[model samples]
Target chain A: MTHRSVFVVSGGTGITAEAIGNSMLSQFGDVAFTQHSLTYIRTEDDCRQAVARIQAAAEQDGTRPVVFSTLVNPTHRELLNQSGALVLDLFGTFLQPLEAELGVRSSQKVGYSHAVRDPSAYRVRIDAVHFALDNDDGGRTHHYDKADIILIGVSRSGKTPTSLYLALQFGLYAANYPLTEEDFDDLRLPEALQPYRDKLFALVIDPERLTVIRQERMAGSRYASLQQCEQETRTFAAIIGRYNVPSINVTERSIEEISTRILAQTGLQRRIR
Target chain B: MTHRSVFVVSGGTGITAEAIGNSMLSQFGDVAFTQHSLTYIRTEDDCRQAVARIQAAAEQDGTRPVVFSTLVNPTHRELLNQSGALVLDLFGTFLQPLEAELGVRSSQKVGYSHAVRDPSAYRVRIDAVHFALDNDDGGRTHHYDKADIILIGVSRSGKTPTSLYLALQFGLYAANYPLTEEDFDDLRLPEALQPYRDKLFALVIDPERLTVIRQERMAGSRYASLQQCEQETRTFAAIIGRYNVPSINVTERSIEEISTRILAQTGLQRRIR
Candidate 1:
């Protein structure tokens, strides 16, 4: 492989950029990727000092550095310019679009308002990016075909979370797909996926449950109406039937029960070992 | 406030599906969500019987039930047909795509694998759907305007995980965005985001440290090289200077340091009471 330059995503408190960068990093394990957050550089001089450190590293290594960052203001941007690294300005990029979409000025500090990543799932500590890439199967498509089991459902049907659990715990390469209105209209499988008929597994839920889910987003929107939800649920059921799709009604099932039952039915192994 | 149905996702060994389902249920504070796993239904007859119960509930409530499930084979799909609930087929959707992309079939019993949502990041339990949504900032631009801080950086810079930590730990509404190549080329803030500059903050990382990170995926891909990585870092630094962006480098800082530093720099109130 050719010698690659260092790509630095600057701007502290940038969790989303961190995630995307982590995701991208997952694709090329060979690249040496490091992330730093400039948390308290307030003045131009402070920025200049920071820039000196960055420039020193680049010059010492003779490697070009690429920086990804969000700045507090225009002067901060200028200070970073002296560092001589390629910069991706997230603030500038989203400033206009975010303003237009929200009808308000950008509050770049939004990330500081919330603290949601919980470390309770596993006894061991894992960083967010490491955990996501370690758990993500976005590029692992073949694993789906080899899966002894499969999950299906509409949005919020619990496919993603469940799949992660299986992969993390039982070593299952579980994959999920959403059933959209378009699929219901044709009442058929996407032509692209017609081959896995025998291996296909379906997840079914009650319309009442779906309506409750939609209510969370738009409590009283026409889309969340009981009648509309009911119709959609019924249509989904009918579509599954028309295709002779095999499925399981998960209305009252627990994760363990579902996995066990599916494994037993298919005569597949329960664990890797 | 319409009568809504509840769809529960469950399956797989090690309680991955169940854990995910638990997360999904937690998202809705006011809804009756029930979980059932295949463990309870051992035979085809048992599956048929379970479907009947679901159907009965739907009929009583005048709503169709939604099912999110992971099953070992298509047989359960047939059994679920006995129930009137609508079905979503995850296996069918993801299996082929994965197979095509990875050139490796999913393991017969690979464990849960939703990697994007770092279950370990938050204090509460979350499922796959929850993980996906956690990354989705509300569509409103003003959403971040009301935010205490915005996180900016490249992928895997610990954005999603950090943001989630802030949200769960403090109830802060955190939103994050990815910085793309296009953003770097343009250098100027995305016109839409021009208004939020005042509240903006940046995250920075050291080039050497970043190289350490990129090495995990491909070890030596050009994209992951220190030289290439350094160039990116310099570019980012320069852009921040040009735009006068306020930023921080997270090269050697812990999450606490980075998070606390951001809070101080932005002068935002801590979420904890």
Candidate 2:
């Protein structure tokens, strides 16, 4: 129950710091965390000013702050090392050995991870994103041929977001289809999705959670009713079972876990590095 | 141009490899990159086998492979270091120095970054993704009160994908509204969005690109015509300027660039680390 302050500091966009912080959170459980990016650290004064703020915060808390940093520059990293916080220098720890192993110097550039210098990879991601949107909720089922994976699920069962996540993160063409009342009544896969059977994945959620999610969208309607949710989920489960659809119960899973599981299950290649 | 093979090897999911590869791509431009994940290397044989594969690949190409790795285990890393390829051990370079700075040892467990051990952060991301989908293209304008930022643009101008990317990557509750013909004719902000003017951001695209994109969706129609695309884009630009809304021309930019710029412009806090 002890309180602690965690600061994720970076010389760039702080994505590395955020990622490391996420890992730390997963390992250590919950802690109050803040993110700071030293994106404009041009001079020694700027680096010192940034460090001073971390020092002041550590002093106020009466505990050494835990700072996760990915500052690529040596001068900026040195300034952070002078702070009262316990610094985890991501780039400093990794770059030299990397340089030696590669027999070439590391670029040591800031904001390189999410930089848009490579238009081709960037374009791949954008196209995938557009594909996800175009095919969301069975909107454009004819494009299933283009999709790497087609996620089928009842309404509000985590299909849309998971599809988008797969698209954006991995540049996978993910299309999602909602199992409607007609499909459930017949207990069959939709005709359009039949040809792409191998490309199909299913997402299921707890009926209770599904109801709650639907209620947020449409309060007091049959679509949001617990009875309808239970029936739809039961029918959807049968449909997935009949078709041998690779499925995940999303009630307790994150989109990362869902997408990773989908990729692993389907043995699909991510288009981007 | 010399053709070189790039390998991303990791004891966990090869996210570090993907990230570093992205940076390398930005700095070094294009190369043939491959990802090989050594997820569960529990023995010497596992390490040796992985290393041999890399050596074989390097030999085939007549060039030492540039390997970006996040292998946490010492024994496994040593095995890879012996390979003929140029190996960059991401964790090896960083962990010890981080351990010294923090006065503690890292767990050195693999798959730490995308691990679903922290349900709170996972839930936050899921909720944000759902929010983004729920409010997409003004589908549910009432929820604008809850949105961190509402992206407004003409149809097919990269609004939907950007909104979802913001949500998925940063857990920012982004809502997008497609400025329709009715709004354009009036030459004013949509009545529903006026109260949230400060939260408004805009996306503009090249009319030619818009026509091509729309043609893919619905060809040989007014919606896909170059003249219509130009007119809608022109009106949207005027509306954005009239409102003094922060906007980005997505003609030459990628989704990563678009989302990053949105975050920078809005100063919105990402719910995730």
Candidate 3:
């Protein structure tokens, strides 16, 4: 396997640069890489320092570093270009076209992208996180009317993470309910969730993976047993069929994939957008 | 503001495309855009379908749509290119150079990139979220030894969301403890937190913002009063001076910014990379 020096440099948190860089790198399955994420590289001086670090890393690794940058300032972009690394300028590539199409000049400000400019809008996202926490896992089922979506599944079937992800990423008030053994006995939607059936979304997982997942949480209990997992899987399917709830199997899906699928399947609006 | 139709198309969840698109478009602050996210566009057929949708929307909106995509398949890339919608091929622009440097052909497999290939590793992030929940708001201070970093802040001072973001984004075990009047009585770190001093990171917020945030949560209460917020801010500053703990003022910063700055200032490593 080949090794490479990788750097994700950005003016803001560097998250956008890293996301696209990782998505692209994920396609190349062979190479090994060690990533250095240098964020808050706002000024020309920061850019120069970033380039120096990238150059030193390239020299040490005996390979040119791949620098993924979202630096908006032209001066910073030019300074980093001098490093001669494989610079993937995430912003510079598309900003000019967007600017031309919009017939406006880009602001080119570093950091403070959305937070300070619209504090109230950002606060809604934070409030959604609190709402998810307050209503997680049948904890506050009475508040179902307020939720944008309600995820239902057996315990350890990914209801919690999905709820949290929906809240954090999309600013959606997502409440989840873990279908207990009693509900599986008759394969019926929980009485508490019946009132908000329109907002229901079911998640099912493979039995083998559920066993492994539950085993990690509780090693020897019946809950971790393969038999229990299979039963739960069957229960989820039966309930989905009976209730006709919009559903997806989340066995191998990332939170991003699952959340996106949910939004697409349910035609739910993301509050962030 | 000139209105335009924006499309984010991707082979995977489309998160990478949307993130980069949003980050770049944030620079062009004035133009109004209606974004349509098209995810799971994998095959040549899917690409053609995506283009049809984009072209239709562009025509309806009376302007060319801007497409941000991370499509990897060369055939799919060519098909989308023909859409003539000002496509920003996020992966195509950088993958060839990466392939040349790495000396390998790209896998180009869409979705299931990380989840199925490395389920155990992905499970670590979910486990981190559980850890954050289990230890949230001084619930399990005894588990501090397991934490990569412990955030200390006043209530509604961005501790909970920051902790959750740290756990979800970085896979770091982040437990947050809210400092109360009891702790601020003598401007001291809580006795429970003293043992974890090396892992301590303080978060301070502007009194005006805190008052407003608190007012939203508990309107007309003493806790939401500007006087109470001012006192808490002074208390936080005093405690930070006394304990000499590393900290940041998260008054106007996003969770991403605050979390990144926390990792940088504390030199705490993110477990994801």
Candidate 1 per-residue C-alpha lDDT over B1-273 given as tens digits, one digit per residue, 9 for 90 to 100: 334354433223323223323333333334444434444444567567667767776887776765544443447655665466654432333344433433444442322322323323221233222432344332335555665556666554555544544443333555555454566786766554567666555667777877776676568888678887787777767766777877878776545456656665666654331
Q: Model 3, range A129-236, lDDT digits (tens) per residue?
A: 999999988998878889999999889888888888888888899999988888877777889998999999999899999999999989999989999899888878
Candidate with more favorable, higher lDDT: 1 or 2: 2
Candidate 3 residue-wise lDDT, B94-126, digit = tens:
888878877888887663434323676579789
Model 3 TM-score relative to the real fold: 0.96
lDDT tens per residue, model 2, A24-141: 4443333344445444455678778878878877787777777777676788888889896778776676566545544555555664643244556666777898788888888888
| Model 2 / residue B215 / CA error / Å | 8.3
lDDT of model 3 at position B113: 37
Q: Write the per-residue lDDT of candidate 1 for residues A164-189, one digit (tens) a residue.
A: 44433334546666666666776777
C-alpha RMSD for every candidate: 24.0, 4.9, 1.8
Q: Name the 10 consecutive residues with the lowest summed lDDT in model 1 chain B.
A: B114-123
Candidate 3 residue A176 C-alpha distance from true site, Å: 0.8
Give Cα distance to truth, residue A20, candidate 1, Å: 32
Off by over 4 Å in 2: A1-12, A25-33, A39-89, A104-115, A120-123, A154-157, A180-187, A204-252, B1-12, B29-33, B37-52, B55-67, B71-87, B104-117, B180-187, B204-253
Write down the DockQ of candidate 2.
Answer: 0.30
Chain B TM-score against the true chain B, each candidate: 0.47, 0.87, 0.94
- Model 2 chain A: weakest 10-residue lDDT segment is A24-33
Interface RMSD of 3: 2.6
Please say which candidate is ahead in TM-score: 1 or 2.
Answer: 2
